[model samples]
Target: MKAVLFGIFLLAAGNASASCDLVSAPCSTDSSGNTYIREQNLGGGYNTYRNGDLYSQTHQQLNGTYRETYSSGGYRTYYSDPNRGATYQGDPKGMAGR
Candidate 1:
């Protein structure tokens, strides 16, 4: 029983470390004067929330594509390995944070 409790505690701690919840994650302002909030996704991506809403979600793909899906249902696909630029689709709004 003690080991089970310890395992549960460890799992919760790991989740807390990667959460994108504004109350838990660190926040910062960009040079453009926008405030961004960060969150971690359980899947293959991380999120940036702005003004209490999901501004963008950046995810990794098996084919080495890094895609950022924005609030407007738009996206930008980039290569993760070489760290190249992104190809935009849909209406491109900047990734603002919550």
Candidate 2:
């Protein structure tokens, strides 16, 4: 019974390390001097954030494709590899029409 309890404790501790919480927001000012808040995911591949007027998103797939979305209804997708430069897809104008 004691060994079983110890095993359970170790399993719980290891699972906790897989999850994370944001310590603070990432903020910045644009060229027009508009201040905004930004948040990033500590995990490299995928992250999501909510700012004052925009919702930002990012994802990096295992196949080396990166995607980002903006609240303005626009999204940019890119593919990165050693043999080629970053290729962009989707509507550069905005996703409002879609």
Candidate 3:
């Protein structure tokens, strides 16, 4: 599985240290001693929260595609059919298709 660093530097936000291993503790602390916790949602999805604030969330769509949304209003979608990915800033006009 790929490592998803839901930390301060996810988009070069800052220089906070974070380690995420899916099969491990599913938790990490940044440089400021803030702990981020990953918990599975009630249904089929997971959310990463920091200090009680929602940081990011990932959910699988009905089409089997995975979409991740961030607290900053950004979003990313992983398409398995085309084996590609796309990221958008705060709006659809800032889409960076890949």
Q: In candidate 1, which residue pairs clash? A: 20-39, 36-97, 49-97, 49-98, 50-97, 50-98, 51-98
Which candidate's lDDT is highest? 1
Higher-TM-score candidate of 1 and 3 = 1
- Leading candidate by TM-score: 1
Give the residue spans of candidate 1 off by over 4 A. Answer: 1-26, 81-98
Clashes of each: 7, 1, 0
- Candidate 2, lDDT over the whole model: 0.46
* Model 1 alpha-carbon miss at residue 6, Å: 37
TM-score of 2: 0.39
Which residue pairs show backbone clashes in model 2?
26-38
If the candidates were sorted by their lDDT against the true structure, best first, what order would they fall in?
A: 1, 3, 2
Point out the worst 10-residue segment of candidate 3 by lDDT: 81-90
Q: All candidates' TM-scores? A: 0.51, 0.39, 0.48
Question: Model 1, range 1-98, lDDT digits (tens) per residue?
Answer: 99999999998876543333335564545455445565677984678776557788887887878777778777776655112223121212343231
List lDDT for all candidates, in order: 0.58, 0.46, 0.56
Off by over 4 Å in 3: 1-25, 31-33, 79-98
lDDT of 2 by residue, 1-98 (tens): 99999999998876543232222443433344443444445775433332234455666767777666666666766564211222211221223233
Error of 3 at 3 (Å): 44
